[model samples]
Target: MSETELPPEPALDAGELDADDRLKPEFVRSVLDAVEEGDTEAAKARVEPLHPADIADLIELTPADLRPALAAALSDRLDGDVLAEMNDWVREELLAALEPHQVADLAAELDTDDAVAIIETLEEEDQRAVLRALDPDDRAAIEEALSYPEESAGRLMQRELIAVPEHWTVGDVIDYLRSDEELSTDFWEIFVVDPAHRPVGTCHLSWLLRTPRVVQVTDVMRREQTLIPVDMDQEEVALRFQKYALISAAVIDAGGRLVGMITVDDVVHIISEEAGEDALLLSGAGDGDINEPVRDSYRSRVRWLVANLFTALVASFIIAQFGAAIEQMVALAVLMPIVASIGGNAGTQTMAIAVRALATNQLTQSNTLRTVRREIVVALLNGATIAVLLGIGAALVFANPQLGVVIAAAMVINVLVAGLAGVLVPVTLERLGQDPAVASSVFVTMVTDSMGFFAFLGLAVASGLVG
Candidate 1:
């Protein structure tokens, strides 16, 4: 089936496991029931209704304490596609729970990339045992993939791909495809390669099937194809796929010989990961997978909160500067928080947009100034709209029109500063070769909160509205 047409899997029912979500709770209960009964037939029946992805999600969602029972129930039915969909943490746990030979048996059913992903999570000793359990050829392929750097194209690309000699006629290609016992499953295109086994061009399966049998493979092939280097980072590989709108691209080695192929399907996973990773990094929440252990979750999130505490202290220090003003005029204390809160929210909004744009390459040095100007303009309009409403409210509440004017002016200043800081901080951080998403929020919040307090309270004191 086409990627878009792939059936929905619904047995996982993990976090956000509302009844209406794709993976319903009822299905999860059914799977557990079957596992408890030690009925592999019933377990497969329960899962047979779900998609491979959903089956994978179900495996991941099964409580760690209950996984061995579930795995034993599923038996050989726990296939490659299901393994591919499992979260890393859960996958590792499951692999450890199984014997090395059992893990190797299941992994061997997968494509080389999926197989590598599964085996890589095993303990080093377990990994060695699993590798030894596989057939020599399959073991060699997995070892070759493990040799590559983590998250590189070599580790992710499928080793199976169809390639043909440029000299072959359609008739020859047709007969070969029909008779060859060893063609890769689910290929989109047939690559045309030179004698050195380097791809020169590619022919879409649609074109291959429609052409006259007498036509040479080269006659119908498109020579201008995206060639992926095995060593390219997965992020760069995803960028190339997005930029070129590629469905599949051939992976070549140092000698420019076809080694494997990377598909849009794999790119989909990379895009999801990179996007989710940045979101988690921005919030100082590492990984953010629900299956992650509690200690790990706390360890990742607390450091960021500690950093936020230091930044919050800096904002508080600014507030201390206007202590006399706040003491003399209670209005200063009430109004100060309003300014900081508004500016903090505004800065967060702008920062989120900038970070996303940077990830998508929609915001870059070329349009950095333009983006900054646009956000500043946005802040000005937002400030004016909010200030008018707030100023009028403050005037009536405090029974002092002058106090309203002080706050309104401060509001405008703080918000405009927020917009500028929001864009500039992340952009500057990125330029300095740091991940803008990783620590940008803390810095932007510090600027907005400190400036908001200083502008509002300091102005009230300077305006003689307070002793």
Candidate 2:
């Protein structure tokens, strides 16, 4: 930001962070230098001006060994907001370094959802310790959130929200809001509730400020609003927020009573996380966070690699069935790999698109066939282009017209099968209640590789090229 555009008293220095919001290297170096020099106050002064997110980033950027010293030097700045903004792995490590009471104090300062995130990952004993340290009200809220399944809307929503009865006028709301010292200050809207505390409407703060004091709360509130079930998946919650263009929505219990609220900021995090997760799952990299521990990264990736090995064996077994043809015609061995390679690439291209479409809810029951048909047409065009090029080149190099025609036919057949497998594998897995991104690559790769070799060799023999 330019000097003039900056706030009169900015918490964040405009020049300290790069375009990507990362702390500048020089700033990091200066802070670390002060910390190492035992000038704790200087280090704090340098970091104290940064935003909570930037403090989190600074801690993350610090070396593992030095993080303790840095955290100590700036312990006062490492508040709940900074912890909430930190990476999961990093925050877990930092929280581990603190006492249960200290962690409880930090958790108590946060909204119910963020507090739950920090506490839910603790060991059972540690969780109890933290819970015991928390105030009863805070403990109860966190305990209730913990009862929900991991990654459910209940775990994502915060208990802190603004809810006023519909019978109240704007004057009453203004008075109540002003009279109540403990109400959350972060709410964007005042949710209008029924006698039973179920959300009936939502009134943005702007509506309250603009309306006359005599206006009934129901008169200005928007009646149509999305209500999220507490048990809904976080991913589905994100989709709902996106579909409705919501800034915030009330989360309801099974009885349709208002329980908590999910804000757009929470959905943004879920969107980024799920998008990255789906991409990693497609590649079988499993929780592909660089901050992940080495053993965890190894364990997650190795299982998939093992599955891939078995899938490779299936393709190898297919290749063995055509050994006689390969022995008779050395040309078959020379060109078989090319066919498989092309088919595998083709399948991956379609699979990525299909998985993303499925994730974003763009590809649904109504459009499945249409999507398949479109991919088939694309596959045909792609296959024909590659086949013609390979065929012409093979005819010239091998000096065999029959061989070129055989491989060309095989190329077209394999690519077509590849496209079908790419879409069908994920879709079928989704239908069977499996994660398409998780298992689709293995099945799709196996289908493409096996079908490629089988088609090329089978077509060559059928064309009498081997004879």
Candidate 3:
């Protein structure tokens, strides 16, 4: 190479990652540059030192056109761990490019849950092919996992837990653990099961160490344990973990037999995903991931926009009815938007609180009335404060006390109606077996906008400010 054609930049060292442990922009660009230049060795070497998640990040950061090449360059290092860390959309793309046997190999290296996560997203025919390629044992495990509904405990649990018979002595448990090289090493607690394979108690490692070797495991194990049903929604699983401060819990089937286990680490990922999912769903944005496909993003978002369009027409229809009143006093038109906009914001704030409360199980049938009452009182206080301030300003600016009273009264009515709708819409949807977050915003926005326009204009005519 000529002197003017400078040597390629070297790989980033350990210090190059930012404080959040995210790979730096320059580092990512350098690796991508190496791949683009066809210097596969340089690209591989640059990524070799990074963690699996970081490697996943590097692939995600690579442009879509370059992803396959980058992935190919790092194929030796790309295994179950990196795949597990990848964004779901990106992983699906990479997995699609791989042969069924290749996917089986990756799935074999993962625990049951991670393996299921990787495999479940495959097409039905591809899923069957991958299953055929898997070992008999792995195939059975994955098949059972796939049988459960998506996002249930069965789909999220790993079958690699250590479960000891209830009759085993501490010494017996120790001997089996020592001798059984096939047993999983990642567990923090061991489940003690009865003859029927039903979990009776849980034994922490510390307890086993402190107890006498001759003592029965059941004697030392904690009898009070939270058992998660196989069909339990993952959100409820997260709530269980949070409420009980659980390190690990047994996942049981309909027969009350321990089928697998879920640890805190798995629940942590679920918690983040659920929280973000609910937030996005509330905004009518489906699966708001940056790596989401353009078509998918468009499809999910446009439907909501269409829904909003219909909702907006309802408000428009209200405004059209009062066109004469608005035209009679131009100030009415100028001030009307303030009522709607402020009411909308107020509704959003209350709806957020209600949704969060419901998500966390803090708002339930036992206390729904209390929550409603509390929000109503809060809305009144907010409405009154804003109304007083707005009233004075409208009075001074418009030089009409009656106009000020009209707008101020309309603001209170709209905001109060907004707050009421915010809570009621979500609760009502939830009761009707719909996801509150997914439909709440549209309904709440409709209520606020319609009431804002209707209240302001209707009150104006009654107050003799116009029309």
Top model by lDDT, which number?
3
Local distance difference test scores for all models: 0.86, 0.90, 0.91
- Greater-lDDT candidate between 2 and 3: 3
lDDT-sorted candidate list, best first: 3, 2, 1
Model 3 pairs whose backbones collide: none
1-467: candidate 3 lDDT, tens digit per residue: 63223245556644555545447666776777777789888877777778898888888877787789889989999999999999999999999999999999999999999999999999999999999999999999999999999999999999999998988999999999999999998989999999999999999999998999999998899999999999999999999999999999999999999999999999999999999999999888899999999899999999999999999999999999999999999999999899999999999999988888888999889998988898889899999999999999999999999988988899999889988988998889889998999989998999999999999999999888786
Clashes of 1: 0
Error of 1 at 393 (Å): 1.9
Q: In candidate 1, residue 165 scores what lDDT?
A: 93
The order of the candidates by TM-score, greatest first, is 3, 2, 1
* Model 2 residue 60 lDDT score: 91
lDDT of 2 by residue, 341-401 (tens): 9999999999998998888888899999999999899999999999999998888899998
By how many angstroms RMSD does model 1 differ from the true structure? 5.9
Better of 2 and 3 by TM-score: 3
Better candidate by lDDT, 1 or 3: 3
